[model samples]
Target: MVSRAHPHGDDDIRLLGDDSFEQSDEKDNLISFDDTSGLRHRGPSSSHKKPLSAARSVSPSSAQDSPKGPVVAVFVVVFDAKQGNRIEWSHTVDGSVDIGGVEYKALPSGAHTVSSDSLTFKIGSYYGVAYFRTETDKSSARGAVFRSCGLLGRRLEDIVGFRTVLQSELSQGKHSTGDYHVLEDLVGGRSDFVDNAFTPVMERVNKSEIELMHDNKIVRDFCTLLGADIFRLWKCVLLRKRILILGTPPFADLCHIAHLCSLIGNYDISSPLRPDYNLLLYVDLNDIDKLRQSKTFVACTSELIYQLKNDCYDVLIMKNQLHIQDPALQRTCLTSAMEKENFSELMHDYNLRSSIMHVDSGRFDATEFVGGYFTALNEKILSAFHAADCTAEQTIADSALEDLSLNPASDVPFLQALANMHCPSIRVQRQPLCPQCHLC
Candidate 1:
C-alpha cells in the first residue's frame, strides 16, 4: 500500500542510468542473488521501472500492508553521460554502480543509497556517502581525481579491505617461480621435494588425539568457526575441545588469538593442564592465555588430573611454568557462535529432550532461558568456551543463558560450541557421549 504524497501527477520521479538512454529496447542492470553468499549481481534483463500509479499512495510511516514497519520515501535523481559521468558495473562488487574501474560511487542526487553485494553506501549528515561529481581534484592522490562521493560510508574502509582480499585471490597461481609449465618436470620436482624434505621426517607422532582422515573409518562430523572474532570459538577450541592448530598465520586461517586475549586480559583456569601439543611450530607458553579444562591437554592419553589446579599465565610455551597470579574466572566474552541450520535442528532436539527431562513447559529462545534444557545446553558450551563470559558467569546449577538468541544467529552457537561445529576454518573435536563422564 503506497500512500504517495501526491496522487494526481506522475510526481513519483523515475530516474534511469546512462545505459537506459543508450539502448532504447533494453533495460537497466538487474540485480540478482548469487548462491554462494546471497550477494546481488546484475542480470542480463535488468530493468527496474515501477511507474507510480496516480491512484495509489503509500503511508508516510508504518503502512499496514508492509511486512517491515516504517518506510521512508527517497527521491532518486539519476546522473547521465551529459554530466561527464556514467555508472558502470564494478568488478570487486556485484550490482554496484561506480565511476571508473572500482572508483567512488555516483548515487542519485537525493537518493538515500545505492548498494553492492555486501555493502550499503548511503547519505548521512556531515559524513554522507554515495554522491558523485563530474570534475576531479588532483590534490588527493597521484594522477587521481577526487570525484567527491559522500563521506563516512562503509565504502571508505570496505574498499581497502575488499581490495586486499581480492588481490590475494587474483594472485593465486600467478607462477612467480617460473616453473615453465611442464607436468613431467613438476611431478619430478614434487617427488624430489617429498623424498628429500618431507618423507624423511614422517615419523609416528606420540599422544595422538586426531587421526588422518583416510586412517579413520568413521565419518568425521565437524562444526565451523568463522573469522568473525567471536569469543565462543576462543573457549571452545583452546579450552574445552583442545583443537589442533592444523593451520596457522601466513600459512592459513590463523586462530583469532589476538582478539581473544585482548578481550579479557590473560587467562587463569581453576583446573590443571598439561598440553600435549606436538608441533612443527613452537608457541610461547607466555603467549598462551587459556588452559585446557579437561584435566590435561596431553591428548587424553593419561587420565591423571592436571597439575597446578590453579595457574595464571600471560602465554603458554613448552616446558614453561605458569606465572602465578590471583585466580580469576575465565571470560566467555558473552558472544554467541550460533548458525541458523544447527540452531533449528538443536531446537527440535532440545524440545524433545526437554519433554523427556520434564523441563519443556518453559521453552527457550536465544534471548533468555532459565533452568531447563537450555541451562543444560548452556553448561555444555560454557565449560567448552574458553574465554571468560564478559557478562555474568554461570554455574551449571544456577547459571543463565543470555544471548541475542531472539536473532536467528543464536541457534548456531549452541550447535557449534555444544555440538562440535560449520562455516569456514571449521574445527573437528571429540564429543563427550560417555555417560560415565560429566554431562556435556
Candidate 2:
C-alpha cells in the first residue's frame, strides 16, 4: 500500500505531512457525488468558434468546439498556511467525474515562491490555466493568502476567457459573494450565461486569446530568437533528442517554447510514423527519476541546478543559447548566420504584409506561415526521393539537402529514415521503373 503521507513521493506538493492531510472537511463536503443525470451539455453557440483553416485541415482533433461551453471545471488552489497547497474549491460540469491527482498540477511547481504570475499547462487530456495572486489579509492564517484560479478544459483556446472571469470573481471576495453564487447558473446550462459573463472576453478570444493554435506573436518571437538555428533545433526534435529548457520564475514562456519545439518538423499532427512529443511542462530535482525513464521529451525547469544533470538531457536551452552534448550536433554558426540574413528578408516582407492587413478586416495568421516552412522543407525532402525513380532518389535528396544548407553526410540519412517511416503518408506513390529495362 502507498503511504497517504507521500503518495507521489517527496516531489509532491508540500501537503504530504500536514495535519489536514488525513482529515479535511472542506475537501469532502464541497463536492457531492451526484449522478451523471444532473449534468447537462449546453447547446452549441456561435461564441465558441473553431480553429484556423490549416489547423482544421491538419487534424480534426486539433479543433475542439464542444457543446459543454469549452470549460469542464473551474477550481481554486491556495497555498494553505497549514496544509501547504490544497484545492480550496472546485465545480465540474459532470457531477459524477471526480477531480483527482490534478490538484498537484493545477498550480505550477514553484508558484508560491513568486509573487504573481499566470501559466497554461497540460494535465492528461485536459489543459489547465492558472493565475496565481498575492493579497494582503491580516485576519487570515498568514498575512497574505496566496490563491490561484485554475480552469480545466479540453478547448485551451476557447476557455482562456475564463481565467479573467475567475480572477475577477476571486477579487470580489470568494467567501460571501463568492464562486458558488456567481457560477451556480452554469450548472443549469443557461444559454445566456457564457454570452453575459464573458462578452468582452469572447470578442477578443479569436483575435488574441489563441494559445496553441495560431498566436502569431509566439511564432514570431520563437523564430526571431532561434533564427537559422531553428532548422538544427527542428532536426534534433525530429530525431527524438532529450531537450531541457531552463528559465526564471514564470515558466509560461518556457512551456510555450517547449511546445513550439515539439511542433517543429511534425509534418502531420496525427501521423503515426512519429509519436507525439513527450512533454513535461515543469519538472524539478524530485522528478529526476521520471526524466530518466523518458527516452525523448521536452521539459522545462526553473532551477539552474538541473544544468548539472548532464546525463538526463541531450540538449540544454538557456538564456538564448543552445548547448548540445554531442560534438557532431554543435551549432553551425556559419550556416546559422546565413540563415539569419535570409530570415531578416522574410520578416521584412511579413511586416509589410502585416501593416497593410492591419487597415483591413482580414488579419494575417502566422501559425501556418511558420509551421508551413518546415512542412515545405519536409515535403521537398520526401518528394525528392519518392517523386522520382529509386535510382536518382539519392541525387535528388542530396541536391535538396545542399539547397537547405543541411549536411548531406548527416541529413541524407535522416531524410532516408523519415522516408522509410512516412513514405506512404509523405508521398503516396513513387515513379515505377520501366518494365523492359531496370532504369525508367
User: Which candidate should be chosen as best, given TM-score against the real structure?
Assistant: 2
The models' CA-based lDDT, in order, is 0.23, 0.54
lDDT of 2 by residue, 1-440 (tens): 01011112223455522232222132221122222111101111111113222221212233334544556666666666565666666677776444554555555455555577666665556766677767888987667777776666664554545556666666776743344545433322342335433222343544443553235555565565555666667677766778887765545555666666665555533244554567666665555776777788887766556768888888887655667887755532123343445456556655665566667845665544555555555545544545543553334435455565445434544454455565533322223333664221
Tens digit of per-residue lDDT, candidate 1, span 99-136: 22112123322111222111122222111113232222
TM-score, cand. 1 vs. native: 0.18
Score residue 249 of candidate 2 by CA lDDT: 50
Q: How accurate locally is residue 366 in candidate 2, as Cα lDDT from 0 to 100?
A: 53
The C-alpha local distance difference test score for the whole of candidate 2 amounts to: 0.54
Please list the residue runs of candidate 1 whose C-alpha ends up more than 4 Å from where it truly belongs after superposition.
Answer: 1-244, 248-437
Top candidate on lDDT is 2
